[model samples]
Target: MSPQQKALILPEKQGNFKVGSRSIPSPGIGQLLVKVHSAALNPVDYKIQDDGIFVTHYPAVLGVDIAGIVEELGEGVENFRKGDKVLAHGNPSIIDQGAFQQYSLTVATSTAKIPSSQSFDSAATVPQGLDTAIAGLYGKHLGAGIAPPWAKTASDLEPKYPIVILGGSSSVGSYTIQLARLSGFYPIITTASPNNEDLVKDYGATHFFDRHLSGRQLMAAISEVTDSPIRIVYDAISLPETQSVGWGLLAQNGILVLTLPPSVKEDEGKGRKAVSTIGSPHVPYDEEIFRSSWAMIEKWLSEGTIQPNNYEILPNGLEGIIGGLERMRMEQVSGTKLVAHPQETK
Candidate 1:
């Protein structure tokens, strides 16, 4: 029999998660077998368990943010070696590659070495949130089609533009604010609860407004800050209300990027557009851009160009994830990622 490992598994569509056993998978070409140290929870995890979206197989393992040590490397994987600490964006739909397991396989190109400045729990919070922000801001098909800061001639561009990110305290929103700053968007405006004002500003938001404000009120407040047109609006919390706010704030010919389906209707005459962003690098539309971005993640984290989100470690290892996900569904978690130490599971 192959070696076995502990995993949190969903037995069926919309099924409850439970501790289970699965065989440790081998590293295939361009892959690394990682011993998962920390796995971070996201809103999508509970959504998958509740709505059964984006996953088809039974007895599936679900998680996207992973940080761990490489146990072995597959053929053609040259950049990483045994025992290298790394962080990766896991594809939860694939059982062998999911983050909710003690061991899983990770795609080499999408994995980056975790810098000494970050712990496994902190690094685990970055993969999914950062990828979503990247796809929403820089992807041609999935986002606003803006030039990424990593592009060769991006630094030569001179025109400064304005951007608005709804839900600035969210993981995705925070990363979007930081990347927008790197892209040279001036007066980076964001909306969040007043308690998170300092947090979002630290992430590079040039202007902040209370998220509870009405769309008209938000627009009025933003007007007081910048005369430049709002060409891009990223609704990290794409609830119907937030979507409406983002759409209302967008300029003609501007794009409104949404993490969920857009609730606002687009008027053809106005030339405003709404785009739903997919954060997975496994998807073809975002694969290339993610590959390029992944190459720079290590340097970015090490240099403090990108800061990982605030995280709280969960108790009882894998079992604690259930309560954490419940808290997320109940809207109890705020401004922090919940990380579980899988290896600590009993």
Candidate 2:
């Protein structure tokens, strides 16, 4: 094996990405060195390049969703063995662990083995998006505080409650929909482009509305579906307009969880609240919660409880990621994740 690996490197803050060489890193205790077979693109990757957010160093490597084989396991890492297929949530804050490279080191707690039924491309689409959903739904201080469905003591009785998910066609939104269903949230409602209505529905959204629907129109449409209080609204888009819509639909005391910063003004003394979520498990407070959720991923995928986002493989390997991220920035990627194969970089 080459001592160095090809990586798509951002040479400076707000700089362009280029295929460059980087040293392969070894795993630390409680971590694993993974051969990244497939990497999925996200909006945050472009946002980092354009806005220079999250990363403090020059030549930053950015990407968060990865699926591959475990090449080496660090001390105390008992869950995965070398050569086992796995999917992990990449931590872009650390250069050696970023997903834009052919190999990366990942914390064992945030990594899960891929079930035999899923492919690397499919599993690559799950980590960041699914973790965001988990964080927003279950992170005690960061989320809506719903009980996780995978808990052994969890009640299987279906709760006849309503949950609204904004931007259901997005990678995170789609995962949010599936987790909502698993928690027995009744009449799972979401918004998406009319053409992709079926896609969100297939992910367990009980009802889908056109994304262009006005807040008033969406409220009326959703009201007809169920009069149950809309206690949780997960806004995957979290744009100003979407946040306003979600805030408007939320019942008193309900939480409006946003993937981005809260945009709408809160009503005084209304008891409704808007909270933004930090998706990565590396957050000090969030690791334990995400670790528990990550433990369930393999079973979730194996049983078809959580389906991965539809994906398109971008050409040119790691170099192709630049165009993919650009398309995401332009909002051209709808309802599907764009994936790249780092090993194919030339």
- TM-score per prediction, in order, is 0.98, 0.97
Model 1, 125-167: lDDT tens digits are 9999999999999899989877788874945685888899999
Model 2 is weakest, by summed lDDT over 10 consecutive residues, at 151-160
- The global Cα lDDT (0 to 1) of model 2 is 0.91
State each candidate's clash count: 0, 0
In the order shown, the candidates' Cα RMSDs to the true structure are: 1.3, 1.4
Q: Give the TM-score of candidate 2.
A: 0.97
Per-residue CA lDDT of model 2 for 47-159, tens digit only, reads 99999999998777889999999998899999889899999999888998899999999999899999999999999999989989999998888898777788636454556
How much RMSD separates candidate 1 from the native structure? 1.3
Best by TM-score: 1
